[model samples]
Target: MDDVDETPDSVLAARARTGDAAAFGALVVRHQPAAIRLATIVGGSLDDAADIVQEAFVKAYRALPQQRDLVSATPLDPEAVALATTDAQLLIAALARLGERDRQVIGFRYFAGLTEAETATALDAAAGTVKSRTARALARLRQELDRSGVRGD
Candidate 1:
C-alpha cells in the first residue's frame, strides 16, 4: 500500500477494469475533484455539481466494459420513420375524433412512447387498466379511421 498514490491513472484504470476495489477508489479519489469542478462550472451550484458528478461516476462505472463499443448518436431508425410517416398521418386524423381520454391513452401508448406501466402511472390507473384501455382505444381508433376512410398512403 506504500506509495499507492503514485500509481498512474492508466494503471489504476486497468486495475479498476479488473475489479480492483482499491485501485478504483484511488482513481475516483484522483479524478472526482476535477469532475466536480467541471460540473460546478457548468451546473452553477455545488449541490447540483456534486449530484451530476456522482451520477456520471455511477454511469461511467456501469459502462466501463462497454466503453469501447460505438453507440449510434442518432437512434431514429429508417424503418420506423417510413412506417410512422405512412401510417401516422391517417392515425392522427382518426385520433382527432376520439374523446380526450382516448386520445391521451393513444398518445401515451404511441406518441409519447410510454410503457403500459408508465402510462398507468401517468393516468393514475392500474397497469391492467392501462392495458385494457389501450386495447379499447385502438379498437375505437380503427372504427374511426374506417368510418373516415383515412387509408394509409
Candidate 2:
C-alpha cells in the first residue's frame, strides 16, 4: 500500500505475520493508544498500563508467526480471562508501586527489550543515563516484589 497508515489491520497483520517489521510497527503505532487505554482500565494506572500493553504486544509479536490467521473466530473463554486477570492484577499492583521514571526504564529495558542505546535514543538521554536508570529501576522492582512477598524462586 502507498500509505501503510491507511492499510487495513488485517492486511498489516498478514504482512506482519510474514515478518514485515514495518507492517508490525505500523500496527503497533495505530493501536497503541487504544491498547494503552484498555490496559489502564485493567491495570489501574498509566505506568502499569504501559507495561501491560508493551508486554501484550511483545507476546503477540512472538506468537503471530504461528497463527494461521490474524483474527480469531472463537470467543474468549471467561474462565481463561478470569484466571489471567488475577496474575495481571498482581503485576499491575507491583508496577504501580514504582515511580514514573522507574516504570519508563523498566518498560523500555525489560518489556520492550530495547538496548541501553535504543532506550536512550527513545528517552533522548545519554546511554549512561539509561543504564543507571535501568539498574535503579530493577533494584526498586526487586524490593517491591520482596515486600509484596513474591518469591523469585
* lDDT tens per residue, model 2, 1-153: 469877877778878999998898899999999779645543347897787688888898998877887455565677998867765665667777888778777776776667999989977999999999889888888888778766665
Give the per-residue lDDT of model 1 (tens digit) for 68-122: 6333345567799797776755665567667767876776677545799998997
Residue 95 lDDT in candidate 1: 70
TM-score of model number 2: 0.52
Q: For each candidate, C-alpha RMSD in Å?
A: 14.1, 8.3
Indicate the TM-score of model 1.
0.43
TM-score of each: 0.43, 0.52
Residue 88 lDDT (model 1): 55
Error of 2 at 142 (Å): 1.0
> For model 1, which pairs clash?
none
